[model samples]
Target: MKVGILDSTLREGEQTPGVVFTMEQRVEIAKALSDLGVSMIEAGHPAVSPDIYEGIKRIVKLKREGEITSEILGHSRAVKRDVEIASELEVDRIAIFYGVSDIHLKAKTKTTREEALNVIADVVGYAKAHGVKVRFTAEDATRTDLNYLVRVAKTARDAGADRISIADTVGILYPTKTRELFSYLVREIPGVEFDIHAHNDLGMAVANALAAVEGGATIIHATVNGLGERVGIVALQSVAAALKYHFNVEVVRLDKLVSVSSLVEKYSGIPTPPNFPITGDYAFVHKAGVHVAGILSDPRTYEFMPPETFGRSRDYVIDKYTGKHALKDRFERLGVKLDDREMEQVLAKIKSSQGTRYFRDVDLLEIAEEVTGKVLKPRPPERIEAVVSVKCGSNVYTTSVTRRLSVIPGVKEVMEISGDYDIVVRVEARDSTELNNVIESIRSVKGVESTLTSLVLKKM
Candidate 1:
């Protein structure tokens, strides 16, 4: 199936409570989204603020300069001035929205349904007259009377809208209903393509988006980390992954999802929940003994998709539930050589350590040495230990900085502290080459300004 991704991290994502993206951050995010191969980027609502308008201008300039390939979209309302402002930004496409549901009309727009249709026609036509592609969004479309909603969409289409967005503004649709709605719209409207703008108020945005596609939507609107108003819209990563894995339709660059999600998580100041579907930190992690054993035996037993498919690695945790298979795997991977007796001793100590969820590589090394009464030197890839202290820009979020650092493969620990350096990260690697690569990755993070590293000479 052919599908397009319209990521709104800069628009609806900004509407997330207390979330704000600086102009530079917005540009950086746009670049990342372009690299992820999204079909369109809803840059921002130009009518919302001057800063947003300027940001959209810069993004459009990037496209003109050939720095980005995604089509840029500017959001607007039914007002002509709103469309005028967006058109002035020179965005490749303009998205004009107006409430079509009677509830929304009475509560928000205070306009009759007929008047609403007239406004949409006027504004959508105005944008098209200026030679810009237009998408007319019927806000709260799911709750709108089906016949009236169809009329609204047809009005916009007649006025030159190239597409129509069926927005589940309050996220009240079930997957079946969503599919039915899109099917009806696609059957009713012949020329214009359909886009699904699903909100996550009911926690079904991703499901609904996929259903919409199954019905006939060619475009799925999403935001990184599900950032938006209320519970947010469908997550860009989740929807993209679903499209590729569930339907075998690759809409965006799958491998770039993790890095792009991290970038948005950092800038949006909204942490991706550990349980988030595709790009969460624990998405591919296994900790339970039974699960770890199954994963070790055959990843297909516990994993539907390999972590490496998304440029991520599978991880395991060592805690009370740690089984022998998990322990042995960790030990061997860390290059820790121990006899059966010593391994049992190590497991006992770990299990009895109150409730420590994780042990740093250095801590494991110390424990191995203590149990064996000899210096346990790990082999090649696990031989090096380095402490890296990172200083971030004054304006950066320290928690986000720490979260970013903690996810690096070699990084074992990350702490935010009050000092010259905002964060300290401990990393384990094989040699200087791996160490340098890890450090470079750290330096490349958005807020990291500088880093100082020191190699470990001895654990004691």
Candidate 2:
């Protein structure tokens, strides 16, 4: 299973509206993705200009801290100046591109088929002269004439281009078309690796990339949040996840998927779509009753993949839709059992309440104690005596409650804080310090959301 992941977010992702990354932002994202273990990172296209040139160098300098799976590379047109910048950066590879489509040739390059091949041969040779690997991409190959595509690709091969990328630019190629195009590249373009870079207008970028891979394309290009020009590029998270889960090929580490996506989203000012595959906030969030039920029963039953694999958790969202069994299971784990009817009542009470991180098993027990005065403890303390208060949610209606106390050393007397106590407590402790500990412990209790602790002003 040959696998490689190329992060194009810096080059393509920065093209999104309101998206800009400072040199520091690009360096940090590069280090983080390098730590994520991608085999290749497209640092940026140096042909963009000198400022972009310096940013790529910054990332290249940061790579010396330690070796990671990702090696930084730059994108460029098939030209001498672009290849020279890559040489200056000391990058690992250069994606020297040519707009192969007749449309682009007539409008942009204004060159004949023979002339285009010369440019491909000249620039790739220039890059090879500087000891840089070169990848030749037939820009808009999906729309280019097959004969010219073959001719230009052969030119790149003769010039020592290491890989050929068949770009499905504009997301125009569906699976069948993409697979056919890649199949042709594999058969016709001899002695070079082929890659597929797809866009997402029709939302088949990942499928197309995979189809190309199965058709003998070795590398898949992606961006963290699918951030790129227009409809965005193939998502790094989706393609990496698909390869791991579907093909049983382990290439990229899923754990850093969220971190990389998050940093790019932050720096690029593009919040990950809530429903984006894997990294979205709602990717593993469960709210529906059956979905939560299925998750609680067997997470794998309802989930396509485990959330924790991507540095996320399978979260059972609490809501009006949250089931009683979920809450009952929450209590049963704490050695407390409630009848279905009792849990029904408890769930109702919680549904009626708001603004909390869901109750823990212990909280359910406390609720049970408050409502029915049922002590859920399996072993009630012998000589057990403690103050009990009545609370409806948070409002304690009475000023006092009865308390019974006993001591292990068998103290003959119980002390009570009289009427002034707001609510009285009669308890036993080993000594004065122990007594203070008991008082402080209860003071920290939650239903008593606030506390005012004071030692007796003067001993009786």
Candidate 3:
């Protein structure tokens, strides 16, 4: 069976406290998910406000315009008013949900089991009658009594709901229990499509979703970056990669995963942890000496999934524990070829540093040059001095040009002079090549009409 993804980044994900997506950001995310081949995009609930209603309408228009291929769904409660608002938005599907557990019904909705079922039947029937698909959700399904959950499922099914969603609303379900619950539901509610919406409070959201799939669930609800209430739901990147790599189940475009995650993280204002799976900053980085050596030899030795699979490249971080192989690879990538002796010297320096800190590319190059007694690039001369006069089109450009010239690599100082020159600059270089390059850099600055350079033959 082909498992489909129901991305709720704009719906349940926006429910994350302190998280809000502008209307444009919502549309952009929907388009990106559609392009990524997601089966459905749950735009926010229309009943929330006119802004959300307009957002859903815009998504529907995108689908109609053929800009997006995925079906757009709007969320709603098991209330007639909610369903009516969703119908007005004209989404491809309407997700009608109601709290079925005893606690939620008592403390939240304050409705009896019978009354809740009646409400589900009415809303499901209303949504179906409006010529739109209906997905019924049993909010807090894992905590609800099995008998009551079955009755609620049967009520929605009989009332013409197209699909049923079992939400681990509080993330209380684990792998084994999730499998068992879905297995029972799939057996009892035969012929009805089932979706799983797992939360991540227990950090098992992805695992539980996979378990549900093994037990016959065909749809998995997830949010990009796992953005949602109190922790969040299953992360789209994690679950999609798990489904593809672990289960050999292809759901969405794997390569587009990282881009989607980045887009959501930027617009959502919720930064993803560096250790977050798949899309995290450190997810594909290797720092340990042994691991780096293994990865350098063959990436598959230490990595289960290649970074290229998600549009990311493996990063070999250099620190105190870096191996010779990793260092050699890094030097080659930087266009600095190091011989065996030179390589060992650089490695020794890194290991003996006062504090264990990673070296930047420039720092590493400098270290390599120092150890090899060779310069990768020409260095500025130590004692030579020169005066540069810069002419600018306007006084407005003089200060800016002086500021620019003051920061060039070989520039020692800059001053605005009242002579024929607009600005007088003093520079020093180790060799003619370095001085010439610095002069060229100064000439290249915008608003500089011309420059005259005079070298000091002898600096007594």
| Top-scoring candidate (TM-score) | 1
Show the colliding residue pairs in model 1. Answer: none
What does candidate 3 score on TM? 0.81
Q: List model 2 lDDT by residue over 337-428, tens digit each.
A: 77777777777777777776555444566677766667768632223223422121135422211111111121223333333344434444
C-alpha lDDT of all candidate models, in order = 0.89, 0.74, 0.87
lDDT of 3 at 2: 65
Best candidate per lDDT, number? 1
| lDDT digits (tens) for residues 121-146 of candidate 3 | 98899889999999999999999999
Candidate 2, lDDT over the whole model: 0.74
The candidates, ranked best first by lDDT, are 1, 3, 2
TM-score of candidate 2 against the unseen true structure? 0.74
In model 3, the worst 10-residue window by lDDT is 376-385
Ranking by TM-score: 1, 3, 2
Per-candidate TM equals 0.85, 0.74, 0.81
- Residue 128's lDDT within candidate 1 is 96
Clashing pairs in 3: 380-430, 381-429, 381-430
